[model samples]
Target: MCNALAFVEEPTDKHAKSDGYCGRILRAQTQGTRRDGYNEFRLRVEGDPENYQPASIYRVTLYASSPSYFRGFTLIALKEGTEGTRDDHYAGKFQIIDEEDTQFMTNCPPAVTESTPRRRTRIQVFWTAPPSGSGCVILKSVPFKKILILLQQLLHYYHYH
Candidate 1:
């Protein structure tokens, strides 16, 4: 049950992404499958994601644009070009930093998530690269923006009622 792929089923909700691609930072999520413009959220990696050595660790930071914050999120790393492929497995393991607020999910890719939602502008975590020969990886995430999250709750209430 901890495998957070959550229905992998399409969210029929009007607010959900039609393609069901949820949150892919580097992938092409548009009409022509081109990368979208930068959002208010940023996922910054301290090391070279393209040249990471086997079994190495890198610092990852998620920052929301000033005056904005998020309460929860899920982050995962996948090797480039492996999206939706049978080999689309997670490329590394995450080192938990805030045990009180964050946790590593037991999902197929063993991603990291918020254990207890907390509003904040930035969240940091460390990722250990996979074994030898693992190439560049793309960190992907779906951040629950604070205000939008509240809007979603209201929408859900109205939709259900």
Candidate 2:
């Protein structure tokens, strides 16, 4: 019963071909050392040019079979090619829901912000795996609108192992 989080990223382009969306699972790997009835894990996700667009915010949600085995989650955005600089361009937050799910919201900095938009190839999330052994975790992502748009148009299905 390894703990995990799955997620999906919708295509940035509304007119994208195919089903008009893309999804994937967040890969979980052992991180550091486990101690005090808690285990550390890192969830890594890659961004695809075909699915990701500049200046778009993606809402990622993590679902667990049971909340008792879940602990807490954190996201740390780091600057590219820098050792100690914190990147503020991207913003993210996590929320626990009904003891069964966790929602993560991430905002990508606007492409036009600094004359040159930074493209992120990867995102890293840190979480504490429950010692009680949670079954599995699922992560999903969808587009977040800053302007008026149909709520139905924003819905899509994506599943990852």
Best-fitting candidate, scored by TM-score = 1
Task: Residues 1-161, candidate 2: write the lDDT tens digits.
Answer: 33333433331212222232221111111112234644222233434222322233443322222211222332322222221112332223222322232234232221101111222222233223223333333332222122122223334322321
- The runs of at least 3 residues in candidate 2 whose Cα sits more than 4 Å from the true structure, single-residue gaps closed, are 1-30, 33-51, 63-68, 82-84, 87-161
What is the per-residue lDDT of model 1 for residues 35-67, given as tens digits with 9 covering 90 to 100? Answer: 255355677778534466677777888777776
Angstrom error of the Cα, residue 31, model 2: value is 3.2
Sliding window of 10 residues with minimal summed lDDT for model 1:
1-10
Q: Quote each prediction's TM-score.
A: 0.63, 0.24
Candidate 1: clashing residue pairs, number: 0
Error of 1 at 137 (Å): 0.9
Pull out the clashing pairs in model 1: none
Q: What is the TM-score (0 to 1) of candidate 2? A: 0.24
